[model samples]
Target chain A: DQQVKQNSPSLSVQEGRISILNCDYTNSMFDYFLWYKKYPAEGPTFLISISSIKDKNEDGRFTVFLNKSAKHLSLHIVPSQPGDSAVYFCAASAQGTGNQFYFGTGTSLTVIP
Target chain B: EPEVTQTPSHQVTQMGQEVILRCVPISNHLYFYWYRQILGQKVEFLVSFYNNEISEKSEIFDDQFSVERPDGSNFTLKIRSTKLEDSAMYFCASSEKGGRYEKLFFGSGTQLSVL
Candidate 1:
């Protein structure tokens, strides 16, 4: 079962534009959400994360917004750069879930120059 | 910055053979985990190791699977009598604490091909 889902399999945007990737989770118990970026032939790297109590978290150009009532979250990359082109995965976990995360099928983002 | 490291970037094994995927987490990290992703599939959690014991495991982690921190720095996952379905990219991750907000550091995955 896919507890977390990223309906958009791929996305493309021009460099210096905004790239938004959406994610939805079926489980309401998930209290923590995160976004990870992965490059070809490499493991995923942590991008940003948000707690259930907060609606948004930002780190440099990357910002993650969580809508608890809607069970959805989106990652926003401002002024997207070519280097940001990669597969992005959204992951979630509950507060007492022992750090076991559920991941969504990633969205491939391509920023064209 | 310290990072998690996995050995043998690629492994080819026959069905029914036992294979071990090794990982060396950051020395200062206390929580470790194993995750795998089949081709075109989402990354799935296998197990979480904390304090040298399994904290949680998904249905994917069956009797044939086991994890151990054989030494202070090494955490390993062993699949006994592997099946062809076991072919996938296995990732090792670690975090300083098991807190909900802590971000995980993932290692370059080990690609296992079951023949």
Candidate 2:
């Protein structure tokens, strides 16, 4: 099912630059969005999340922006560091869907020092 | 910090054989979930368990699959008859609550290879 899609398979950015990862979802029922970072052989770690009620949520250097009208969400990381290089995935869930999350294929982000 | 733990980092089994993947979720978590990701694919939800019973399951979770909380802390997923397509990284996740807004804490994963 193509419920959630990450069109960019890979991204590269210089250190200290801003990194933006985009995600699109077809199901409008989704009310909660989340971002996850994963290393090569490890499970995805929760990054940040935003609810439908708000358009933006920020934590430290990470910020998540949601555009319900466009059915899109984006994760922005400022002053990117080499340690931030990893695969990022976007997931979403509906209120009555028993918290079943729909995940994207993921985007590999590489930060060049 | 507490983390979810999984056993058998990798397992190779023959098709039609039965396989069980074990996981110990973080202490004090009330929700448990199983998700699998095939090579070069997105993670897919299999099932979610709470209060010792399954609360939700995806279409991918067929009769061949089952989850149980035999004890108080350990949660297990069993594939009665494995298929080649069953080969993937299975992740065990836990959340403080089963609400839509709760974030999940996932284990490193158990890679199951069905030949």
Candidate 3:
């Protein structure tokens, strides 16, 4: 049962450009969302997260936007760099669900130098 | 910054053999979890541990799977009888607090290969 889904398997963008990755979750119970970036052989590293009460959260070069009504969320990387190339996964967890998180399949983002 | 640590970066064993994957989560974290990802598949949750007990587990965690915090600082996952399909990268994660709002820190992962 895939509660969270990343429709796009891969995305590519030129350096110094914007790269957007989208994710959708079917479970309305999910109130917390997070994004993780993973390299080829490394474990996923936490990038950013947003609570259901907020629509957007921004970190250094990454920003996550959540649309509660649409059950969708997106990650935008501004001025993408080659180091930003990695597989990005979106994860969600519903309140009172203990510590279990549902993760999307992940979208591989390639930033061309 | 502290991080989760998984041992035996790679493990190879015969089918039906028992295997134990070890992990040491950050000292202050209260919640620990096991997740695995088969090549070309999404990361799958196996179990979550809190208060020295299993708080939740996924359907994929069957009778053959078990988790333990046998000591003060170590959390472990054991597969009684491994199968070819059990080959995957197993990740150990931890969070400072228990709840949906807290983010998890994941280990590099232990690659298990059942021949």
Candidate 4:
């Protein structure tokens, strides 16, 4: 059983447009969520994270929204640049536990110029 | 700008042989973890360690697998007997604390191939 799930395998968006990626989880115990981006042959780089205490957190052009009531979260990138194209993974973990992160299968994003 | 580092970007070992994948986590981080992804599969957690002992491990981490923090900076994952199914990209990560919300920094990963 996959506790964290990303139903989409890929997504495409035109440059300068808003790109939205969604994720879902079955475990209500998860109190925090994170998004990581990865390119070919490199490790995943931390993008943004949101704690359950707040529904949203923003860092520059990236924003993460969490809906605990729905057991879901989403990452939004505005004015999506070409450099933002990569595999985005959604991860979550139980509250107050060790830093054990459960990652989604990843969604491949393509930014078209 | 601390980052996790792994040795031997790639490794190949014969079946039944013992193989150890090494990692040097961020200089000051205290929590370490090991994860792997088979081609076209989700990244799965193998084990997590803190204070030189394992905090949690998954069902996939069987008796054949073991983790050790041999020194102040080095963390290792050893497969006692290699199997072809073990071929995958192994990533090592570290965090400043064991808090559930802590963001982890990962290494480039070592591609392990057991023939």
Candidate 5:
């Protein structure tokens, strides 16, 4: 089942600009959402997370906005750098659902210098 | 940084053969999980383990699959009979907490190719 979907296969942005990645979910039961970044041959590294109770969460240059009503979430990175270029994945989980995570196909972000 | 480590970065096996993928989770973590991703697909959850027992498993984790924590640190996933469709990258993850909001630390992954 494709509960989580990242419609964008790839995104390119100029360095020092803003990069926005979007994700949509079909499961309203998912209360927790997270973003992960991964490099070639490496594991996915947690970037940020947001709870359904909150609309926005920011950490350093990364910010995650959640709209529970629309079942959509977006991750924004301000002043994007080349290092930020990687595959971005959005994941969601529901409490008491064995804590299992459902992940989207992923978006490849390329920050051009 | 404390991270999960997996052995045998790549494994090539013949169909119907058995393969065991090993992982070493973070020292202080209490929950362990297995996930696999096909070449062009999203990562799929296989199973979750806690307190030395399986807490949950997905449909992909069938009768032929098993997990074990033989030692205090090592977690292993064994596929009784490999199939060509089983080719994918397997990742092991661990979390400090058991809740859904907890953050999970994942290993680099083991690339399994069933020929």
Candidate 6:
């Protein structure tokens, strides 16, 4: 049923510019959200995450903001670099459960130099 | 840094044949999961295991599928009498303490093709 969705199939941005990726989820049960970055022939690596209780979480150049009332979340990479280009997946999981994360189809990001 | 490892980067099996895929999760992780993606499709969960038993499984994991942690290091998925629809890239993931949901490390994936 695609409980999680990344409507944008791809995005492009110039180096030193801001890049934003968006995601929406239909499942209100989800309380935690995560973002993963992947390159060709490589495993997805953890980027950043936010709990439903908080509105925003940041790590250096990357930031994740969760809007619980909107059932939406976003990942923002400031001053994007060429190395930041990759496919980004947004995943959602419910609270206190071992249930696996439901992943979106993924959005490819291109940071042009 | 610990990472999930999967064997036989690619496998091509005949329809109705048996296939076994293997994975070695990070040593300290307490929970393990399997996910698969057909080309051009989103990743879907197959199963989750903890304490040598299955904690959860998806409907796609049917009678034809089985999972085992035969030893301390290896986690395996066996598909008995496979079919054409079984072709997909399967990923193994592991997490600590079971439920933070902040991060779940994934493997590069093992591509299986049933012809």
Question: Candidate 1 at residue B110, lDDT?
Answer: 98
Alpha carbon deviation, residue B44, candidate 1 (Å): 0.7
Candidate 4 lDDT over residue span B36-82, tens digit each: 99887788899999898889998889999999998888999999999
Which whole-number lDDT from 0 to 100 does residue B28 have in model 3?
94
- Name the 10 consecutive residues with the lowest summed lDDT in model 5 chain A: A92-101
- Candidate 5 lDDT tens digits, A4-99: 999999999999999999999999899999999999888999999998989999999999999998999999999899999999999999877877
TM-score of each: 0.96, 0.98, 0.95, 0.94, 0.98, 0.95
lDDT of 6 by residue, A1-113 (tens): 99999999899999999999999999999998999998878778899988888999999999999999899999999989999999998988886556777889899999999
Worst 10 residues of 1 chain A by lDDT: A93-102
| Candidate 2 per-residue lDDT over residues A37-57, each given as its tens digit | 999878899999999999999
Clashing pairs in 4: none
Instruction: Give DockQ for candidates 1 onward, in order.
Output: 0.83, 0.85, 0.81, 0.79, 0.86, 0.71
Q: What residue pairs clash in candidate 5, if any at all?
A: none
Order the candidate numbers by DockQ, best to worst: 5, 2, 1, 3, 4, 6
Q: What ranges in model 2 sit over 4 Å off?
A: none
Fnat, model 2, is: 0.82
Best by DockQ: 5
Q: Which portion of correct inter-chain contacts appears in model 1?
A: 0.84
Model 2: which docking level applies?
high
Per-residue lDDT of candidate 5, residues B1-115 (tens digit): 9999998999999999999999999999999999999988999999999999999999999998999999999999999999999999999999999988788999999999999
The CA lDDT of each predicted structure is: 0.94, 0.95, 0.94, 0.92, 0.95, 0.90
Query: Compared with the real two-chain complex, what DockQ does model 5 have?
Result: 0.86
| Candidates arranged by lDDT, highest first | 5, 2, 1, 3, 4, 6
The regions of model 1 sitting more than 4 angstroms off are: none
Q: How many residue pairs clash in each candidate?
A: 0, 0, 0, 0, 0, 0
Name the TM-score of candidate 4.
0.94
**Model 3: DockQ score:** 0.81
